[model samples]
Every structure is written in structure tokens, then in C-alpha cells.
Target: MTAPQDHAPSDVPPAPRGGAGPVHSDTTQSAIRQSTSGMPTRPHGDDVHAAAGSATQPTGQADWSAFGPGGSGTAPPNTDEADRPAFEPDRGGTASADHALAEPQRVRRLKIALMVCGAAVTVGMGVAIAVLMEEASPPLRVGVASRPTGSHAPAAPPAIGGSSGASGAVPGNAGAGAAPANAIACPLPGGPAACPAMVAIPAGRYRMGSRRTDPDAQEEELGGAERAIAPFELSAHEITAGQWQLCVNQGACPPPAQPPQSSTMPVTGISWDAAAAYAAWLSQQTGQPYRLPTEAEWEYAARAGASTVFPWGNQLGQRHAHCGQCGTLPDYAGLAPVGSYPAQRGLYDMVGNAYEWVADCWTPSHAQPVPPAQSACHEKVQKGGAYDTLEADVRPVARTHGDRATPDVRVGFRIARQLQRTEQ
Candidate 1:
């Protein structure tokens, strides 16, 4: 008798190429239908050929080759048509007619492999997403970490008012004995509440000059050493017009060569001697130690915890400050008003607002140290490059010297105060 042809179940969908969901077949459904009809199922042995030729073949069919008497779980080897078995197994397992009811072995293995692969893909995606999120947002730092004198490790800028007292009040200013270890810079006791706004600076260390490989390095900015700065307070903004005018009105300072259009704008064209006189007048009025920042202190403050050429970064960005190559805005003809740009570490206009005078006397190079003083200085150092200053010259380490008696439209100044002993 002729062997019957093997046929695949209609309910089972084709297996996917790569790892996909589990494979399902109609093995259980076929058995349920046959048992419900009270039909005695024919064995897959010699009855298939007789059933096929007599037109009495069962419609409810299942693959049972793997569990049959003479069958293995895998497909049989290839042979001639006449010698081959009547049924062939699907990709997962062997096929046969000897057994009436049994699940194919290959289908179970395919389902297990697909389930494991699907689980692995899900876990891999979860880990990748978590890593990306962490890189996108770093945590904020609450305290300053000490660094070796010249270490180039990047430091995060502290929050406004520093990690110490919030109101710019330090324990040192309260009394004399060893102050609380956490107390930072504050205005001296008895200072007016409305004195030029100041931001407390934490004690820190930094390299004092341009790197040896800098292309813009000048003789005066080279051969410098590392410096350790004590805690102090620096003016939040460059000295404004109203602030300078107050000094002139009290007769403690000479009138400016040109009046500023707005009281909030920085006062310019003031000689170094005149700027020093204003600082002295402010100290007397507010009862705070007010003076020009030393050259080293000015550079350190301007850097604002950055190691790049510019405080913001290495490249020049639009509207960062009012410099020639730093980009322009429609607001002003000359200098933008004080606090017009975003601040760094609570201090505004550290660079590119105006040329600020420092407390150092101008020497040919940084090889020799110049002591900071408010008097008896011939040539004074200028920092924080002016609005018209070139981009190449608008870095923390860049400097220019001016005659102490001369005042230019581009030159201006800000003040700094030292932190006193903390309260015991």
C-alpha cells in the first residue's frame, strides 16, 4: 500500500528567524477534539496507509514521531522517496504515526530558547538606559574638596554663599578665637546691610599663571607659581556708576571724566589712585575691609573652578561677555550694564565687562613677586579684559599694565574683603 503524505498543523504560526516569542502548535487541541467525539484514534503504525487509501483518514491530526516506538526526537536522515517514512518532522522535532498522543520535543526547546532570549534583551535595554541617565545629570556638590597646590583635577563650583553660613555671616567676623571649622568668608562686623553686594568665596588653591605651552602667554604671565588663597568676599558685580558717584559726592573720590548713562552700569575711566580712594571711602562708610583684589586673587576668582582658557570653556560662546570676538547684542554701544550676563560662583563680570585694576605693581615677568598695596605704586596691573579687548586676550591669565595716574574709558575696578578670625 502507498504511504500517506505528512502535513503540518494549521494552527501553529511559522517560527521567527532571530529570537522571538515562544512557538505554539495544535498538539493539545487535536487530542481534545478526537476524545470528545468518542472516536478510537488509529495508531501511527500500519493504519496510516490504509486510512489514506480508504478515505477514512482522521481530520484531527498531531505529530507524535518523537515519542513513538522506533522514533528518536530528531528528524530522520535523508533517503529515497520509496524508502523514506510517510511523515516528516517540523524544524523543531521528528514526526511519526506510531503514537496517538505525545508532544514534539523540538517545539518545547524552541519555546525555551525564545523565552530566554526575550528576557535577556529586556534586561540589556534596562541597563543601557540607566547608564545614559546617570551621564546626563551629575549630582550637585555641597562642600569643597581640598586639592594639591597645582593639581589639575576639575573642581565643581560651590553653590551661592558657599558651603558655610548662608547670610554672608562667618563665625570669624563675630569674634577672635578659633572660628568654627566650617565658617567661611563674610563682611567685617559693623558693615552696612546694603553695602556693595558681595559673594563669599571659599578657601582654595590654583596655578597662578598661564601654562608653559600657551600660545598667548606673555612674559609677565609666565614663570608663575601656584598660590593658596584664603577665604574672602568679592564684590558681586563690578563697581557700578551709582556706587562710584556716592564716593565722588562725599568728596573722597574725583569725578569721572565721563558720566555713565545708567546708574547700574559699571563706572569706567577712573585712575588706579582714584579707584583705591573709592575703596578706602567704602571701607570707612561700611566699616568693612574693602580693597582691590591682588593679582593672584583676581585670577583665581575669575577662573571660578575652571581649568579651561576661559572660565566658561575653551571656545568663545555668544553673549558670554562683552568682548570684541565674544559676540554682540543690541542692548548697548559700549559696555553692558553690570550683572547683564550670567554669573560664575555668584560673582558677575569676572571677565570682558571692563578692564579691572589689581593690587600688584607691573613687572616685566612673573619671575619676581610684586607685593599688593593701595599706595606708592607706579604701574598697576589690569585684569578681566575690557569690552573691546581681543578674544585672545580675554582669559584669566592675560594681563596689561597701566600708569597709576592714567585713566582710560575701558578701565574699571571691583573690591575684595578678607575673612576675619572665626568665633570660638
Candidate 2:
């Protein structure tokens, strides 16, 4: 074996040796391919041989977790040259010609990395559906705060007029009080004093008026006119024509062909069925029932609880109301009694000296269940509206109409009730 050390091997092949050619020894690649297939071998040569030094096999170093065969996922233990085994077929190793052209280029780079992860999941689901369609749309709202826009100004409307703070209409103190016992009888059939004189009002919920109808006191221009109204109670006065001659002395009020020289003045030209038959003869001589207030309960009882429109709020003049103010009578010329006009609205000739009558019953405007007194068969709603009307018709829901029979100095009526049928 020592003699075999006279080597020239690193797969020897420099060619042209003496005394017998064709002897290439890469150790034994199947005996050098069975002694050089078909001969004419050119396994390179070595002149006299005996060069010595190619007996390797001592390459020590292999710990990649003892590699291959044991765990099986192959390839790590070859440590550079542990007897460098593989080569043969006359040692023509060129790394097996680049691992046979790199196995189909690793299956074409794994199908181009799964088509670039499915087009990045279809462009991130089309940008999350365009941010959920801009968060589902619809919301314009500006005004920075409202009434035209921001910087805060617009206020001021009060001196005697303000209401409609909640906006339902007609509770200007529907004639001040009394009401709560109606099993039915409001027919006023002929009981002379027909109705009125109930008065107590109280349970509270005010601030009515302002559905803004003063567009220069309107002939019909009508723009955003939602004049509001609240509070409630009124009638503590007016209905005088000598108190409808005590219902024509009780023939159930039919007499006034035109009498009344002055029972202290207040009643006027009559008719909401002669002021609901004199407030149903003062609610059947005081058993308590009454009726007539729904122009929002007569301006929510004429702003009794006060939010304004003339219980001394928006100031219409005549010092505050008696029409023509200090213009010294005659303009509306008649009616005065019922506390001669003053309580701003807490009571008294509502706001002037004439236009009374009002247990409601008309609606070419106001709107609500309020149409009962025979649905305008002729006329019946009236609230402070005359003295020829004009300082914005003396507000507090100012309105007018007549003919429940006729009688006129300017027309008069007041009183209201039905708080679930009056009597308490």
C-alpha cells in the first residue's frame, strides 16, 4: 500500500505515458468505464508517473445536524471533500452540468409566485370598495349654527310679542279659566245668558304667538309665516251689549235688533251664536261648563303666562292698546268695560276695545281639529282684530269673523273652557 502512494492522481490524465498507453485511473468509475470504452483513450497523461501526494480521505468536518437519510429532507453533510466521491465516467464532473440545467428553472419560479399573490388580492378589493362609497353619502347641513349662517345675530322681536316657542298654536290663555265637566250640553239652545264666566286657567304651558303674520299685516303675500303661539287663558272680560240684554231677558238671546245704549260697554254687534249664547248662560247659571277658545286657545290664553305678542311684549301702541292709543276715542268709537283694557294680556280687552268673540270655529288659516261650530256655515271666530284694525291688528293671534246671528258695535265675545269638559 505504501508503494501505491507513488501517485499522480487528481483524476490523472495529462496523457502520453511510455511502455503501454491508455491507463487513466480516477480510482474506479466503474473501472474507468470498462477500460476506456472502445479505447483510443485520452485520459490525459503523466510521463514517468511516481509523483506522490494524492491519497486524501482525511477531510474531517461534518456537523450539519448529521444531515440526510436520518430526517430525510436531504442535502447538507458533504464537508467540502470527504474523499470527494461522486465523479467517475472518467471524472468529467462539471457539477453535473449545472444540475441538469437547474430542474426546469425551479418550476418556472413557482408559477411566478402564485401570480403575484393574485394581483395583490385584486388591488386590495378595489380600495375597500372606494371606502364604502364615501361612507354611504347624504348630509349637507350648514348655517354654522342656522338662521342664515353663523356669526350669531338675528334676535330682537320682543316688546310685547314673542311666543310660538314650541309651535302648536292657539293657547293664548283660552279665556283665563274654569272648565272640566261636559257630559255634552254646549248646545246653548235658548238659555239666555248662553255662556262664559268660567275663568280660573292655571295648570301652565305657555309661550304662544309669532306664526309671524305681520308681513306688513298681510293682504296675502305670505312667506315663511309660521308665527308660533303658546301659554293660554283669556276671557276674564268683554261680552257686554248689556250682557246681551241678559240673553234678551232670557228668551235665550234673540232680542238685539240693535239695542244696548251702554251696560258699561264691551259686547259689540254680537254673533258667535250670540257669543255662544252668552257663554251658555254663564255655564247654566254657574254649574260650570262654558266654551270658546281655540285660535290656539286664544293666543294660549292671551300670553297670560307671557312669552309676548302683546301681554305688553311687542308693543303695538295706543300706549299698549285701546286702538288709536291716545288718539282720543271715536276711531273704534265704542266698547270699553271689561277692565277698560290694560293687563297687557294677563286679561282685559285682550288688546283693544272691539273684535272679541272666540270660542274658535274657523280655519281658512290656523288649522287643527278646531272647525266644529258648524264649519263656517257663516262666521264665528274673532279675537282682538278691530278699531278698524291696523297696528298689525293688535296681535295675540289677531283674527276676526262674525254672524252667528249679527249684532254689531264692533262685535264682542270672550270666555272658554272644556278642559276635558269643565266643572272643576
Candidate 3:
């Protein structure tokens, strides 16, 4: 082995020395110094080095000169040993410090997630409250005018209480140019030849509705209330087909569904709005407050101071009015001439002929009182029975209702004028 060179094998131990000697190779000494550079100086450093050298040595010959304190391969002892702690692996301590430093970041991340979740929940509730406010509004109304053309024909005799004069003028004509001192001549476009007669109703108070104990009283007619009425004038008979035709001719009102079967029959198939429009047209033509009668006034006038169901009596007589089975019509008991029935208080067909529209809103029962002043309403009140009505419905107190825009052949209306104080 050529004298085994000068270096010993790295895994071998030196032979027993007479005094202290190096026990490790240069490479092993360098590794130990790098690993324990930050370790504290110990009183037994040489002994510890010897023990490390012995533990790493293989079971063979090796040089130990390089590991000695003054050997050329040895590094200088660390001078910052006192300022640094010993090289002890602080696994638990270092891990705890790292965890402490990282804890706030984890908590911050957790808080950010919570805030994001909370914000998401709050935005979901604000969208639900805006949808409920748009569904509570009322409806609107539209009006259209329609009329048909024809020649002015002779009107049949007015219904009961109507004047029989050939001039076609109402009795006591006293408007614009007339004779009666207490009445104003109705402003008819055709002069006295185009209008029906009107009756002067005196101002007074009367029981307006039916008594609750009355035999055939409906809940809506059971209040038996008394109303003080102002003096007003009413058409003697329901508006005849000839009279309505004059309105149509003047282009002030719409034409009926069919031309008058006879000029004497009451005009039918009219709606409350159409009737109101007619009254407005008449007001313009006559320069008077022509309108529909109030419910209370209509009932009071129809009763004619009689406490019985019909104007004549409690018993329904065939000749008393034109209802379903109680009319004088021969074959079919359909609509009859306006004056076919008897008159009460100079007014004709107060109980039967056509269901008349009044100037009051509909109420289910008389128990609930309506305000006296007029206002907009969806449904309107109708009074009196129609030619097609049953006997029980012909009572002066019988009541009915319909929508403001509805039209029926059995329905019609008459005009009312507020009496001037002088006229009254």
C-alpha cells in the first residue's frame, strides 16, 4: 500500500495515544463544527468531541490528528456562543411561536368570511317588500256617444197622470214662455211638441223605507226611516220612446236598442250613466237642475203617503200595475203603455213599469246608512218593479241594485228637477 500514504482512512480510529490527540478526519471535523457552530461552549468540549469521533469511527485504523483543537483542519471556535442560545431543536417552542404569529391571520381570514356571509344574507330581504304596493288601484271609465236617424213620429199618450192635450206639452207648461205661474216650461227642443208632462211634488218629510215587520220586506228595505225631502218636479210618466227619440234627434243622447214599439211605452235598455248623461243634456237644454231622484225621495214619492205595499193598498191587483201576472195586457204580459196603470199623487207607474235608477249608491241593507251627499261609487240603487217583475217586487218599497255601467231591457229612468223656491 506504499506505506499507506500519510492520511488515515476516514472511518478508522487512531491507535492509542500517549497524551491528547485528534481522533477524527478533516471532513468529519468540518461537519461537526458546522452542525454545532451555535452551541454553547462546554467545559467537556474535548471529551464530547472525542465521544462523537469514537461513535462515528469504523472498526479499522484511522487518523485522529485533524480533529484536535490546534489541527489544520479544525475551524476557529465560535466567538458569539454566549450571545446565542444552545443549538437545541425547540420543536415545541418554535412551533408554538409560529402558531402564535399565524393565529391572527387565521382569525382575520375567518372574520372576512363571516362578514361576506352576513352581507349576502342582508341583501336578500330588501327585494321582497317592493312587490306588494302596486296591486291596490281603482279602475277608470270611458264614454262614447251613438245615435240613429229617423223622422219625428207621434208619441203615444203619456202613462198614467199624463196630460191628454194634443200639443204634446206637459200640463202646466211654464218655462221660457208658458202660462202656469208656479211652474217653469221644460226646455224641450221641439217646443211643446217634444216633451212629456211633469208633476209637481210638494216638499215634505215621509217614511222612506219599508218597516222591518212588513210582510215582504227585504233586508235592504227594512229600515222604515223618515227623510225630509225638498220640493222637486218629476215626469208624470216614465220617459217615453218618443221623448227619448227627441233627445236622440237633438244629438244629446244615445238611441235605444230598438225603435219604440209604440211611442207610449217607457224607454228601456238604458244604463245609469246613459241616464245621467240624458239628465245632463236636459239640464243644458232646460237651464234647470235636471237629474235622477234620490233613493229616499223616489221611495217617498212612490208611496204617495200610503203605508201599504202598493200605492193603492197592500193587496196586489191586476189592474193596479203592469208586472208579470198583474197587468191588463191581453195575450203576453210584456211591457204595456206608460199610462196603462193607475196614478198616485199625479205620478204614473210608481210601483211597476220599469226598474228605475236612483241617485244613490247601493247598500246591502238599510241598517247601514249612506251619506246624504253624492260621491263616486261602483254600484247604484234602483227602485220600483219592472213590467217583467213579480207581484212581490212591485211593492213601492221594494229595492234592487245594479252596476253603474250595466244595461238591461227591464230598466229605465225618469227625470227630476230641483224646484226653485219660487216654483215650490
Candidate 4:
């Protein structure tokens, strides 16, 4: 008389009464298969128990509680979600599907961060390198000399031979403080073609003494003042042995006590009187005035329009001049070839190589008044320093005294000519 009991389809299994057999829905079987695709199978006895426990489960109820203790419907308590695998599903949706969707975005963010860091490091290195380069460079120096004297004199005109009493005198108003308009270069007649050329020095006033506070200035070089000079022509280099040999071959000059290293070496070991005699002979032959440079004229030409100790700068360097500290050769290895070092204003060896004999009577200091005329020459002033001298002694203001008749290997002389005006 009871209603017929609801029965499952003939292809499906039936649920047991009183929960004696487990009931498993299609969802639970599928979830188990997916989760355990690669897992080792359980023992035959455990498999039978799991099959019986899950056989009668209903659909839409695939919680892991079925496999937990006592087959209870409640799921196990979990405190940390991070313990779950990326492939596991959550309450909201399948966890593996959500992870697959968000993985590309996480990778993209990581790549962006790495790119930004790399770019920042590159920029930082570039900035550091730029700072280093700036620090390694030297500062430029400009306008280190005193103000110009507002004079622009032309180069000397070529020399012309003429008979006139004024040709031997100082030209261009020597004592009247007038700038010379012309300078002449008179070539030595019958002299060797290798003789050093002459340079015209324009008449101008220049500071005649070293500054008292200068590091290289000596006590004798102090008390400097502005001095006026007349225009003149000076030899471009110290007189070489070859140039002097021309006079020697003609019996116009005496032979050196010791032979020079080379014909081009500067003629050293010549006395002041011998240098003056050479100048006189050259004047008579070339028909122009030639003599030793006066003390003021020697300094002006050596300064070469610079107010520095050397023509180049206060500090001495190898390429500028040769001295004991220059390191080019052994100390006092004799003289170097003319123009072996640098030149300023067409003059060489103005600071070193050989001490130059100037046309002034030796005075203890520049403070002493120079006599208007020569009384009797005792000691002559020598400007420029020799190769064996200290670098500080090579300064233009530095001076030393030597006997006029004594010949020294370290002493040499350069000739100067009074510039003359020619009638058109």
C-alpha cells in the first residue's frame, strides 16, 4: 500500500538507507579525478572505503570534508590561504583559472620595475662620470700680464747701406721719449748664410725691475721702475760658433780656448772686449751700427712683452728653456744648439743656455744711480743664466757681474743694432 520508493535510473547506482554506504555525485568524482590526476593511487582497501563513502554524495557538494575524518559534512578550519596551491579552487571560483588570468599581469609589473631600476642605475652612472670629467680638467688662465702700453709698432724694414753720421747714433729720438717709426735689419757682408736672423724691437717703455714680492726675485732685483727704451734690432739667437767662425777665419775674432760641441753651438768663452770687438767689426763690414745690448735693452727684449719672470710664465718648464733642473742634458754639458728651446719675440736663449754680456758697468744693486758716461770698466753686467745656473737665476731681472777681460765657457754675447731712419 506505500508509494513506490523513488529509484535511480537503471544505469546509475542507488543510495543506501541509514547512510550505511557513501553517496557521491558527479561533481565530487570529477573534482577528485582532477585533483589526483598525477597522484599515486591509494591501497585497494582504502580505495574501496573512499568509493563507498563518496558513492552516494549529492551534486554541488564536493567539499574535501568527505575525505576528512569521520566523513563529516563540515570542512576543516584553515588560518592561512597562502598554504593552498595555485591550482586549487576557492569558494568564489576555480583558483587555478583566476591565477592563470592574473599571472601575466604580475609578470608585466615585475618587468616594469626591473626596467625602471636599470634605467635609474644607468642615469646615475652617467652623472657620476660627468662630475669626474669636470673635476679632472684644468682651469683656463687668461690676461695674466699687465695692461698693454697702447703701442703697435710695425716690423723693421729691410736695411739699406748709406754714408751718414747719424747712422751710428741711436735713432728715433733716443732721449726725447718718442716712439721709433722704423727699424732696420742689416745682413753681415761676406758672412755665412747660416747666421741667425735679426728681429726689430719697437721703442716702448716697460717695467724695468722685478716685483719685490716675487718668489724668484732677488734683493738686487728689487726697486724696479718704468724705463724708456729706443727702438733697435737684436739677433734672433745667441751668436753661434759658426757665425763667430766667420770672423775667426778672417782674423777679426780670436779662437775659442776650447772647441765647441758643434759649429751651431753658441760661441762661449768670449770676453766682453772680444764681444765688443766682434760687434765693431760687424758694424764696419755691414755699414750699420752694432754693439752689445744695454742692460735696459737686454731686459726689455728678454721680457718679450711679458711681465712674468720668464717670457712664458713664472714657473720654469723643460720646453721653455734649458737649465740645471730642465733635465734635457747633464749639468754644464756645454751649450745647446742655437734655437734649441722656445723663443719669444724672435729671441732665443734669453733666459738660459749662456750668460749674456750686456753693455753696463756692474753695480751692486739697481738702486745705485748709473753714471751718464763710462768712467772705467771694471766689472760688466751679465744677464740671463747659464746652463749650470739655478732656474731662479734665469729670470729676466736676475743679474751677475763678471770681469770684462775674463773669458768663461758659460758666458756668451748677442749683438744689437741701433735702428736708423732712411731718407726716401
Candidate with best TM-score: 3
Alpha-carbon deviation at 143 in model 3, angstroms: 27
lDDT on C-alpha atoms for all candidate structures:
0.52, 0.40, 0.50, 0.52
Output the better candidate (2/4) by TM-score. 4
Per-residue lDDT for 124 in model 4? 78
**Best of the two (1, 3) by TM-score:** 3
Candidate numbers, best TM-score first, in rank order: 3, 4, 1, 2
Ranking by lDDT: 4, 1, 3, 2
Local accuracy of candidate 4 as per-residue lDDT tens digits, 362-384? 76567776666653765778777
Off by over 4 Å in 2: 1-237, 240-243, 246-248, 251-265, 268-281, 285-300, 304-306, 309-313, 317-322, 326-330, 336-349, 354-413, 416-418, 421-424
**Candidate 2, lDDT over the whole model:** 0.40
lDDT of 3 by residue, 1-424 (tens): 0000000110111100100000012222112111111111100001111121111212442243443344332333334435435664456456445645565565557557866766665554334322221111100000111121223222444433332211221222111111112445766766653555667766566665656676655566665555566667787778877778878888877777545566667887667787888888878877877899888778766766555566666676655665433422221234456765556656777765566788988776676777565456757776675443344456666666666665645567887878765554
TM-score of each: 0.55, 0.25, 0.56, 0.55
By summed lDDT, the worst window of 10 consecutive residues in model 4 runs over: 1-10
lDDT pick, better of 2 and 4: 4
Candidate 4 total steric clashes: 9
Candidate 1 ranges beyond 4 A from true positions: 1-194, 371-374
The best candidate in terms of lDDT = 4
